[model samples]
Target: MDAPALDLPFDAEAMLPGLRRWVECESPTFDAVAVGRMMEVAARDLALMGARIETVPGRMGYGPCVRASFPHPRAGAEPGVLVMGHLDTVHPTGTLPALPWRREGDRLYGPGVYDMKGGNWIAVEAIRQLQRAGVATKRPVTVLLTSDEEVGSPSTRDLIEAEAARHAVVLVPEPARPDGGVVTGRYAIARFNLRATGRPSHAGARLADGRSAIREMCRQVVAIEAMTTDAATYSVGVIRGGQWVNCVATHCDAESLSMAKRQADLDEAVERMLALRSATDGVSLEVQRGVTRPVWEPDGKVMALYETARGIARSIGFDITSQSSGGGSDGNFTGAMGIPTLDGLGVQGAGGHTLEEHLLVSSLVPRAKLMAGLLQVA
Candidate 1:
């Protein structure tokens, strides 16, 4: 039997104005006020689409989260679809001057434009298009916009899990892969904070009397990175030490991250990282565990959901492939819980978390139509 026809006039050019507004609002993860403002903008848009808007208060020093629910004829009879995306970005608030919004060929460049404000906007626009066509979906839809995804969703993990528990399926519009693919599975990730303490003394006059914490930290960094294997990898991205050049450093701090393809491998990697000790005689090393995202290996149900999306994309004149990613997103929580999840359903471009972040302008309409189709059936 032929499926019901859906007539949606999704215009890429018409989408630019709304997307540009979202991209220009800089909401870095650490800045709570900025994130709240971004939420206001999204709340208004969601309200315009006849969704019940709820602004959940932020906890743990983060900003608020916006939950928008669309009413349905069978609202409580079954679980609904959860469309997830994060509003917080990695770039700071003052990044507009250097990386302002501009159109060059097909790429639309701006802060948070591609790495995910564009994707979130696209999802909302999809629902609006469906409403304009007067099409009712099989299930109800809810949109959850979070505040802290760039730093592993520390403040929002519990809320994300709680929300996902009530949903039948999850769709994460994080950035689409460079080849316009989707993500079925994501690797496990763990973060650690490292501190080294030692005695302080003059560098020139009493060099032997003092133990340099900076030197000890450097040694530990090298050893930690050397622990990488075929299944796991480690990197120390941030380091700070030494108040003065002439005096031996008393303390040094660093942050490191680990990633693995499997849960067992990541567990082993975490154990190895926590077991690190100071090789220096008078220096003490401390390792504290931080936020972690467990591995989300796709199951049969996840694959089935992907197949549905693939069929929808095929009808839209574009085909999408699925892959496993090393990066972590909110989908990790839901997918790990054995729920059917489809991720990486976002805008197409490149340079996330960098100055060249952008999305392809030509991809807007097709991707929006794809998302609209999914909302209609899946």
Candidate 2:
């Protein structure tokens, strides 16, 4: 397939070198040091673009967030565009060796490539292209590269909301939809911590004397999985318990996540999940709530922004559609807060949060042009 005739100067081949650097950085969310390194790499690129950079120190043991404000005629005057993205990925530090950065046909494979690093780079490149051509944007542009999004924006939720409130619209460069669509709405997501406690005893000598917390937790997991329905789904992805095989486990813990199409349904799911009790007589269960992303149902303002982006896509020769994605992103915060937010404005790709993660090489230029056009007009 050939790219549509667009006037933008963005070139996919030209973007590869820098994009490779970003993908190779391997900034996983849980590793603050790795994430910090990724921030530095992005900072250097933003600085080279003549953007005024601010490094907001990371709180709660996460890495710092990079906020780059591009020079504009209406600099810091009114609410402008906030292009938000996360530099972190779900892959751990050693993932690079297994999923090494390489190109296969039209795909660029690497750790965090399709999940977000590629999108973050695209945001910067959009600004770079505009600056290179001396094209002035209608509003000020601020790119906020956050450290956490894969594990929920725990350290950056307040920052994302605060910065977004000061902007007229938020554009998130999460991986684009398989159908080449942008995101206008996102589902509500809730995280939970579950703990089970029970009496411990020697497994070999007194198995019946012990009340195993792991056993109770196993029951809880089954029950939690059974709670899934068409409106909302529940999952327990992480679980830890037991010190040794010779002793009955005294305590067990599990992490859960739930997503819903609507806020009300999510609230109901949350209540139900929290209400769980230990099935065994001597065991006790506890459920603690974690960070949440409110349901971002698209409103008139959001739809209007989508209309503008759709028109821009048409000008570039290919039409674009908008979607309400099941996954969550920073757009959930901004869109839910009534700010006009557009998401999935990144490279076309598939296989996010997996070893097979990759992005279409052909999507770089068009997506960058789309981002640049939005920076100019939206």
TM-score versus the correct structure, for each prediction: 0.97, 0.97
lDDT of 2 by residue, 175-254 (tens): 99998999999999999999999999999999999999999999999999999999999999999999999999999999
Error of 2 at 370 (Å): 0.9
- Root-mean-square deviation per candidate: 1.4, 2.3
Clashes of each: 0, 0
lDDT of each: 0.92, 0.90
lDDT by residue (285-365, candidate 1, tens digit) is: 999999999999999999988898888888878899999998899999999999899999999999999999999998788
Off by more than 4 A, model 1:
1-6
Q: How many backbone clashes does candidate 2 have?
A: 0
How far off is model 1, as Cα RMSD? Answer: 1.4
